[model samples]
Target: MAEYITEQKRTLKKILEDNCDRAYTVDELFCKMQALYPSKAPGKSTVYRLITHLVNEGAVKRFIKDGERKAAYQIVMGEHCDCHLHLKCTDCGKLIHLNDKISDELLSTVQSTSDFSVNEEATVLFGTCGSCKKHSER
Candidate 1:
């Protein structure tokens, strides 16, 4: 038989999937969950537990952004968790998945030059996105 997914888990999954472009704090996710399912909203602890479970299962990715007290969580789709650097926008809090030939070249360079193997899963670069930069300049 197929494993049964709980309602709370389904709701949380939907929220993360829907906001894949941005990361959400535990509190923020809780609030959104409550809004979506006020009658059966999971508690804060439950949200945290579920998120942790997802992370361990490789279905979600969690990271701390600069100047943030709480860690943020985002859904991991397909090969995103395996081979891409995440770019986080400081101004808009948008998370962009970067997978380019240059990134591969950089990885090759690092491997060729040193014994250190880059951890792509945990790699993140923070900067203002183009839209945010333009908005700030205007």
Candidate 2:
């Protein structure tokens, strides 16, 4: 049973890492895991448990998406996630990690003008993504 749990944890981590382009709710992740391992996917409770662990370890970020009551989780892309703001696509649920250079400049400007420090980890700019905008135009 211990070995099985370990394997489940590994599989869940891989799924999040590979799909780092977007955040997923618990139900979404469970369905994805079920699709990948129909016979052996862990239960939804187990998925939540493992996700909590990942969040505690800083390997994943969990946030309440805009205009939603449920929380969503996404894998942290790089080592410096705390140093930059994130952009979340409202249409497709994609999460974009802003480049460090751009993030730094923005942060600097905001600080200089407003004298307020933004919590990068908790800050997410929500908008329609490029793909969604293009598709909508068609």
Candidate 3:
């Protein structure tokens, strides 16, 4: 069995994974966490503590998105945690993570030629969102 994370850690991770689109402040994270774990709403310090733990364990990733905050966290899954490239959309500010959809020969060439490994992680692919594109055309 996967070792059970503490209640705070598990709940926090769950909330983060569910809301992968945006980063959250401590208070915001606390509120979201409470939705799943209403009986245990931790203070800011406790929340921070759990986040730090998740970070160190590589279960979470921190990056700066176009927001008022300095950094945001996203839960890492499978090979997405070891991403090689990221895509960011300029018009709508929507970020979607991507892994390469490439041919085996090309993939082999890259591995042989470059000093990098295939990061089969989700990368943020940014582009005008559908709503933005629709509005812009009008």
Per candidate, the number of residue pairs that clash is: 0, 0, 13
> TM per model?
0.57, 0.59, 0.53
| Position 83, candidate 2: lDDT | 74
Off by over 4 Å in 3: 1-5, 78-95, 98-138
Between 2 and 3, whose lDDT is larger?
Answer: 2
RMSD (Å) of each candidate, 1 decimal: 6.8, 6.3, 7.0
State the weakest 10-residue window (summed lDDT) of model 2: 76-85
lDDT of 1 by residue, 1-138 (tens): 113336687778888877776788999999998898898888999889888988898788787744566788888664344566678777756678776666677778898999678897778789998877887788
Candidate 2's C-alpha runs over 4 A off are 78-95, 98-138
Q: Best to worst by TM-score, what's the order?
A: 2, 1, 3
Residue 99 miss distance in model 2 (angstroms): 7.7
lDDT per residue for candidate 3 within 17-131, as digits (tens), equals 6665555667678777667667777777888888888889987766554434555666654334343344455653445544444433445676899956554344344576555
Model 2 over residues 1-138: C-alpha lDDT tens digits?
Answer: 498888998888888877766778999999999999999998999999989988898788887755477889988764466778888777756678887789989988999999998887889999987876887788
Candidate 2: residue 83 Cα off by (Å): 15
Summing lDDT over every window of 10 consecutive residues in candidate 1, give the lowest-scoring window: 1-10
